[model samples]
Target: MGLGCKMISLEPPILCRLPPTTPTSFRTKTIVFSSYAPDKGGGAVSTGLPKAHTYTASFKTLGACKLGISWYPDFEYNAQGGTGAGTGSKVADDANELSVDFDIETLYIPPLTSSTTKFLGLPLPTFLKIDIVPQLFQGNINQESGKVDLEFLAKFCFSVGSVYKAPALLVKTVLTSDESKGKIRGGRGERLDEEGNCKLVGVAFVEPIHDFFMDSFLT
Candidate 1:
């Protein structure tokens, strides 16, 4: 008999039900500017140079979200939040400043794709992992509005069967927002107890994949 042929269909990613007690938390960090002044033509090298000032602030309990007993399908990611102190740097010409680091834990893609309608008897490689990690985020912080504007480029790589793709640039301008309040499982505002500690929902958004290399790998 000649080589046999078979057909296999691939489905899209479906929303799975998460446990009611799925644990998640959110935290807000604040950078406050206490004061500022412009150089009154007083800099040794240049006039109208910026002058330094003093500022102090802390992140209080903005809000939190907790899920009770319910049977709802949701996509949940486990994220931990806690309070700690770290030394930060600021230019001599600036007031208060804050620094933070961001990490991309995973890149999730919906299961189905146009090219993956059906598989013939021929075999194919199994995809193991695809990751895009950025080194640093560059942006400005608006203390008054409690917002941070940042961007970063993503480095991409993936493993398929025994072969691993070399890392390359895949994405950029991964902008994020934290100015809005967060919602819990039930879409309720975060609740605060007598103590300042509050448990809030953590949120992260993934923008469109830009590079064709990334798109091919995902599909």
Candidate 2:
């Protein structure tokens, strides 16, 4: 480990193949929104804000396997009067800085098939993510008003499933890299592209559960 760098690890990865003709279990969605404002922030003495921020994170079980996707979307908020000087008291001060952060993660506990064995071999997971939205609030408010209310939305699509098991003895020939979009389909293949870029294969999520969190974060 370097003086400021943290270590990250993972495991073998399996590929999700699109059906030859039509892909099953596909979902599509879209979101629409609007906002009307007339000086969102009241006087400098008011505690309530005409502007607000919100967050969300979630995962839906596809078919009862032990894996799911993880995602975090940027939030929405009412812009405070800070860009250009306005008529009022300028509204914000050094201590008036307000930044909000939100995160959501969905984990899994390996499930088994109906066979006498203790694991399942049919359940496979994958991921798909695309968020091309950047900070669009800068142009929303007029420089004359100095007050702004901003609205933004984000979306993602990904899947999570296990690859292989260690059989309680073998050191498990682990393979990990970051070629999801083109991360081939096989049991063990960890190679570099023509230019060289490491892929992210599998990962072990054993830091701790609800009970073990205190030792890692609350200590």
TM-score of each: 0.33, 0.18
Q: Give residue 53's lDDT in candidate 1 (0 to 100).
A: 43
Clashing pairs in 1: 13-111, 64-190, 64-199, 64-200, 65-200
User: What overall lDDT, based on C-alpha atoms, would model 1 receive against the true structure?
Assistant: 0.28
Query: What does each candidate score in C-alpha RMSD?
Result: 16.3, 19.3
**Which residue runs does candidate 2 get wrong by more than 4 Å?**
1-52, 64-110, 115-219
Residue by residue across 1-219, what tens digits does model 1's lDDT show?
000000000001111112222112222222222334445675654548444443332222121212121233332221112122212235344443334333233212212122221123221234544342444434433333333333444443444546545444343332223321222232211222222222233222223345465444322
Instruction: Give residue 135's error in model 1 in angstroms.
Output: 2.9
Report the poorest 10 consecutive residues by lDDT, candidate 1. Answer: 1-10
Residue 95, model 2: Cα distance from true site in angstroms: 24
